[model samples]
Target: MNRRMMMLALLAWACTAAPAVSAASPPVDDAATAQALAQAETRGREMFEHDLAAERATDALLKKRMRGDSRVRGWITEPKDNRYEVSMIGEGAVVLYRATTDARGILAGATEALAVPAAPTAYQAGAAAARTLAMQSRIDACAKRYNSVVLPAPGATTDAWTVYLLPATTDPAAVPLGGSYRFDIAEGRITSQRAFTRSCIQLKRAPRNAAMIVTHMLDPTPTEVHVFWSLWARSPLYVTTGEDVIWKIEDGRIHRVQD
Candidate 1:
């Protein structure tokens, strides 16, 4: 069957499933609710694992087909409800496809792969950044590099607030990937981070003057606020400026900035 058919089937099945009673029932006390949550988590894990495996398989297949093609790096997989988005990279082209899987972990519904322009350098940089940011040990490095701006709110005393700033490549030549990022710090130790891509940017045809805008909270002291701006560059041809702000504290957080 085609991927569209498989997706339709999955949608139909999900629709037919019986809905649970008591929409507000807590999972801890409700058996059915607990089971549903567990199942969802399990499915998420399984989907990620399967995606990894599929990427490896696709990589090997591409290597064989290309015959020692150094430009052919690998594949990345994104899983959906009943289908997967797979992108295979090569020297000058990329093959993108939507693949459906069967219960036995076999590829079932398959679509004709679409060839698109490739951006090897940009892809490598993005993949590297992703891997590095995903590691636990890198949290501190990331935090230190992109620390939160703390400032006081106007007309408020004894109340200070801090907001985290996300790290990004400031390279003008690099493609811009939109996302909101936050870091969790406890007792001076970085705990976790919440990061996601809001939209994907095309690297192959990225504009020459591409730039990213990042904003963070300032200190909660009316005296003075220090703003730090850091940028990473893929080339040495770009120029940028850092903006400064002064603010006051209100309600335990920075409320206003002196414009």
Candidate 2:
């Protein structure tokens, strides 16, 4: 992964699988874990919001310069000491623009003139950075085939990736089931990939603030992208892992269900 990817581990903490929950036994949330989850949730929400702001900043320039152009590939959010660096990539496989943002997702110390284009950022400075862009572009291209929302996240270690192709649809009534995929990339190649299910599974949207129960038969724990998805959905998720261990995902954090 590059500096721009997984800039800061959400909450600067490692997410792990929580112990299983037993309905018959009353559950109590762990004090430390609960605090970590809450802190991570706040960070994730802020990251999501800031990333959107970066996109808006880049889009404004795109509209003024290359109107109706799809050469814009995608972007990566890099967190700084107390700010974020958002680089907008173009079809040339280079950063065409960059934006800096503060904590509130507001444009801070960010300005660029559309009158003169910035010199293309050399993709060769760092092999990992270049490869990251290449891999992201590859996924971006394939995303067209699956028609799912593709999110690329940094893996536990650098030079590793976990990309989620989610069935993220806006329609609240009919959830499109299927076509969701999770890909693992490392050592400059796709190491392994898995589909969440053989086909799509549609479930009704829970009311605001209500948690939806979804059975996830893949990992023993919930993935980071799941937290991001939960944040976007504006609702919480009660995910039943393969081991029947239940966890709660909300506000971009996960914790063992306290029943």
Candidate 1, position 36, lDDT:
41
Per-residue accuracy of model 1 over 1-259 as CA lDDT, tens digit each: 7754464344334323422111222225467645543443343234334434454446445544444546543444434565444455543335433344432345554433445544444333343233233333433233223312211122324222212333444454443322324443332344555443333221221133322222222211111111111111221111111234222122112222222
Q: Estimate each model's TM-score.
A: 0.28, 0.58
CA lDDT scores, all candidates in order: 0.33, 0.51
Off by over 4 Å in 2: 1-55, 58-66, 109-182, 196-198, 202-205, 242-244
True lDDT of residue 74, candidate 2: 56
lDDT: worst 10-residue window of model 1: 223-232
Q: Report the lDDT tens digits of candidate 2 across residue range 21-101.
A: 222321434676455455546545653565456556666566655455465565555567887666665544466566777
Model 1, residue 168: distance off in Å is: 28
